[model samples]
Target chain A: MSLHDCRKAFSETLVALAEADPRIVAVANDSIGSSNLKEFKKRFPERMVNVGIAEQNMVGVGAGLANGGLIPFVCGASCFLTGRALEQVKVDCGYSRSNVKLCGMSSGVAYGELGPTHHSIEDLAWTRAIANLTVVVPADPAETSSALRAAAAYEGPVFLRLSRMPVPDIHPADYRFEFGRAPWLRRGSDVTLIANGTMVARALEAAALLEADGIKAAVVNMSSVRPLDREAILEAAVAGPILTVEEHTVVGGLGGAVAEVVVQSHPARMRLLGFPGEFAPTGSPEFLFEHFGLNPEGIRRAAAQLVEESARVAHETHPVR
Target chain B: MPPDSVPTDAAAESVSAAKMARRIRRSALQMVHAARLGHPGGDLSAADILAALYTAVLRIDPRNPRMPDRDRFILSKGHCSAALYSTLAEAGYFPREWLREYMKPLSLLNGHPDRNKVAGVEANTGPLGHGLPIGAGAAKAAKITGASWRTFVLTGDGELQEGSNWEAAMAAAQFGLDNLTVIVDRNRLQQGDETERTVGLEPLAERWRAFGWAAREVDGHDLEVLIRTLRAVPFEPGKPSCVIARTHKGRGVSFMEDRVEWHHRVPTAEELSQALKELGGGDE
Candidate 1:
């Protein structure tokens, strides 16, 4: 498995989309270099709007462009795009129902070691709370490109959270991304491990490790956070316990979204694997993943424990009947 | 304004706009009195500018508000909804009867403008400093697609304190959105105090000029001057235009004019009667 930056796929797909559609416009907040939009700007110079270091204005402008019969993909760092310009996102896109695509780059701890201010661990929580928004967290390059196409084709407001962190291709080149489906990557009945973004690949790897220990663990790529795949979550819950891992905080992230669905319907035993309501200390993303037990080994350990807890509780209730 | 202030076309338009402005002020005051909740000060201050833009300058068809070539107007000082709704009603966007439902429970006429619910409303704006950026984007779209319509945004004087406006101001110039124009209601009063005492936008025109726009000041309540200034687009060929509309908060009513408390204070029956009498009687 080789690591590939999802930003490359995002920009390539965006430029392709622009070439076909005249309505496609890019609104950047002086994040051309970081967002990997140089190619896009080179090809569609007039189509790209560099708003010069103002996330609030950038979002407002995106909303405005949508109002003017143009589709605008507002790109910026996830931290500032969602955190700093939250009200603009809520009012302009959510309430106004503007047709805008917000591509939040460098999500999660992709900017790890740059400190918590740059980390976008709280983005999913903040954006998920807003209505009229479809929040997507794509795992790899193929998934990222598919999500981008889906976002442009579907109207209203959509937020695509892309990561700068390199991850191996998880889906096939011909992968089709759906907004509200949780695809079961490796189906097993013992326990279900749900994750998205960078954590999906790790969850799959964790399933392998759990298999080595004779534990048949399932892995579900639950990418679309807002319009959750309730059927898939309920299906996973019916098998056994569920463990959700994400490259975000334990509160209001992928794990929280999954729990919101599962508890209301399935009521399964669960363990949320992510940053537990604390800012990450200074470390590389790889180190932070290890420290917070987001890696294959840690995830396997947590999932195995959850499965045990579920089995023990079942045994106590059923009593060999 | 004097009827003979300009040539026939300009004079006729200004005279009609001046009457519309008067009607807007009267209707807005009555709506505020009916609702028992509104920003009457800013509404009266912005009435003339709204009237001029909606009538004399904007190329909008009240029948086909969403026509591709029609100009766009966004009231950024959205707390002045009574005046805007009155102006829109007077312009025949919707029946004038909707003005009575101003701020009513579950009414389409929200305290702020909603583009989805209201015809002739280009954008949903209530929070300060949002319209210019949206308008700049709309202008950029026209520039991008080679469309022929222009975009205008109206903001309160006190709304300039939000740094987001400067960001928009800089970008509107950077993109050289000549098709876009912003009118600042220089009413000098916010909800709490005078803009001078609060955040001091004294060098306001210079501020816009420094941000790379063709900035000018005008008497916001003067129909002829406001109409004349607004009709001239792109003040410069390459820069965005900024018209600093000098106005007095609560301009139409003598007692309420420039008074801070009237920023959102509801009028008593006698005050409403006196206000109506001053405006040549209300709703008639």
Candidate 2:
């Protein structure tokens, strides 16, 4: 499997799309180098706006640009873009329903060595709480390109959460991206492993491990977190216990979203795997994932435990039946 | 030019503006009193500026508020929605009857301005320090497209305490957005206390000038000067313009003028009658 940086695909696709659309403009808060906007600036200098280290102002400016009949792709570090400008996002874009594309780059623990301050574990929660804002987390390069295109075409506010950590291409070259839909990467019957972003690749590998242990584990990639795929979740719940894996916190991320769907539609047992609502210690992205039990082996172990526990509960409830 | 520079038509425009200002204040007071909640002080204080812009200055079509070439106006201090709604209604943006529904359940006239719900509203702004950045962005868009239309934003003096405004102020200067104009409603009072005592925005015009904008001060209640100054775009070449309009917290209502308690207080029946009498006559 070849590793790919989604930001590269995103930047390339943005430049190509901008060539066809004059209204497409890139707005950032002094993050051209980090956001991979150098090439975009070179190709379309007139369309790039770099607000110096002001995330709130950048977001407001994006909304204003949209009001002036221009499409603005506001890019910044995930933590500051969402944390510092949450009110601007809530009022200017969400409540006002401005057509601004907010690109949150290096989301989750992708900036691992920088410690907890840079980790965007809380971004999903923050953005998902706002109405009229679509939150999308693409798993790989192909999905990233497709999601960016879709967001540009959609006439409303969208938060595109992108990771800086390199992830392997899991989807086919011709895979079509659809909003509010979760696609099954690998199907099984015993249990379901739901994940997104960097965790999707890990979940697939975990399913392979689970298959070796005589367990049929289904792998579903849930990219669009806000307008979730409730039907898919309900279908997956009928099989067995669902294990939700993510690079975010256990609360208010993909796990929380799936739980919300399942609890309301179909009550089922599940295990949520991610950061457990605390600041992570300094480490690399790989180390952080390993330390947090997000590796393939760790996920397989958790899945086994969930299946075993559910079997015990079922047996206890109906003895000799 | 000095801060008090007056235009040739100052006398005639002032008479007309004073009448309009009185009506606006009366309408705003009535809305706040009827709703039993609102920032009457800011509403009353910003009446003259709103009247001046909607009547004598803004190049807008009431019939077509979203015209491509029409100028944009954003009220940053959105707690003054009563004044904005009354001004918009008086200018025929919508029926005056809508004023009666102010702050009511499911009313189009929200507590703050909502651009989507209201016809003439350019942006939904309730939070402070938002309008300037948006206005700067609009100006930048016009510059990029090489369009002739301009953008204007009004913010309270206390609202400048938010650092986002300064960030946008820097961008406005850095981009050389000459098509943008920010009028600071220097009412010198916030919700709790005086702005200077709260956070100190003195040497205010100088602060704007230091940020690379063409800064000027004017009497906010003087409609002729306000209109004349607004007509003078750019103030200087290659720079954004900042007009510091010195105003009382509550201008027309004698009891509420410059009082912090009236910042978010509704007028009683007797006080409402007194305010209406002071403005001109009984409410329309």
Candidate 3:
């Protein structure tokens, strides 16, 4: 399978957008190479602002640019951009409601060898907790391109987490992105596997494995985590037990979001799969995913266990049926 | 907008600015005293600079606070919102009666200045080191679109320790943001102690210059000097401007001036009366 980096899609979409709209500007904290904005800078030098490794100032400058009638895409490595400048993101971008697109490049455990300091596993929790901010994690290059356009069209703060690690394209070239809706990738009646970002492709693989074992499974691509697709989650709940997977911590990423919806509207048996609450050790991105049980085989095993648990509970509740 | 084109009646303008400063100081005192839970020291210290900008320096319209071309002013040291509110009210951005609702539950006048709630506020800022970067962004935007409007940001001396300000300072110079100006309310004292004692910020003017800004020092309480210095912005062409205004933490009040404890100290009834008498007591 040919692999694609989502950050490339993000940068290409941003440059294409900038070509059409003069209001589009790219602001970074000296991460031009990491953010893949060198082409953008070369095309529009004046519109590119490189603030030299200052994450907090980068976010604030993005807000100020938005206030000055320009749409600024604040691009940086996700760890520093979201962690170091969390307060600024909360106040300047989130609370102030600035039209700033925070492009968190290399999110999740993409920088695996760089250790926990460079990992942006907490970005989803940090950004989603803030009010008036949209959080998105695109599963593929096509989805990344569409999400970038959607973020630009939406006139408010948005956190777009783009992966630097290469992964196979899961969405077609003509995929249309929606802000708060999940696109069902595969349908089944036995169990549903919910995931996003790098884990969405893995979830599809897990569902195929379940199909081989005569246990049909549904797959959902939940990219928009903040304004989660409640209707999809409720629908999945009625189908079977849900197993949420992500390239983030299980405490407050996709799993937490799904659990909140299920507990509030429709209670159902579920299994949350991701990094356990601990600092990830040094390894490659693939190694970290395998170590955390975020690979297809791991997801398949978790889904199988959840299905069996759901069947046991159902039988205990209504034995005659 | 010529640098030296001070109004022909410069002396009259100075006197009026001085009077406006006094009014703002008194209004801030009353607002803080009414709330009994607000920062008064920085409010009193920032009065003269706020008055000068709102009255003479900034190109703003009270009726059209959202004018895209209007000059941008951000209060980075948002704990002193009482002073900003007083100045905005006196400038007719909103009714003077709204000052009374400051810090009240569900009131638009929050403990911090919220741009969404207040018409004249450019940004919601309570966190330090945020305004300068935003100001830099606005200035960069002006440069991008070839807009003539300038951006001004007021930050407390102690607020400069956040490191984000230095980041903005570098970018402001790198972008050659001649339209941007940063004013530091050098009120020596902060919450715990003097700024120098808490974190040494001495030789601050040279620091700004080192960051590629045209740095200047001025007496913050002097209205005439402030208006003149502010009008002569981009003190040097092609560089961002920095005004380090030396000020007493609690100006106009003898007991509160330069006192560390008065940073957020609410005045007693006796102290309020004494302050009013010293400020030439008059109701808004």
- Give the per-residue lDDT digits (tens) of candidate 2, residues B202-284: 89999999999999999998898888898787899999999999999889778889999999988999999998888884534
Docking class of 3: high
Q: What is candidate 1's local distance difference test score?
A: 0.90
- Candidate 3 C-alpha lDDT tens digits along A202-276: 999899999999999999999999789999999998777999999999889999999999989889899999988
Q: What are the per-residue Cα lDDT tens digits for candidate 1 across B1-284?
A: 21113334666788788888889988888899999998999999998898888767887788888887778888888888899899989988899999889889999999898888999888888988888888888899899999888999999989999998999999999988999999999989988998889889989999899899999999888888888899887799999999999999989789999899999999999998899898883544
How far off is residue B18 in model 2, in Å?
A: 3.1
Q: List the residue pairs that clash in candidate 2.
A: none
- Fnat of candidates, each listed: 0.69, 0.59, 0.88
- Quick one: ranking by DockQ, best first? 3, 1, 2
Worst 10 residues of 2 chain B by lDDT: B1-10
Enumerate the candidates' DockQ scores in order. Answer: 0.76, 0.73, 0.88
Judged by DockQ, which candidate is best?
Answer: 3
RMSD values for the candidates in order, in angstroms, are 2.6, 3.0, 1.7
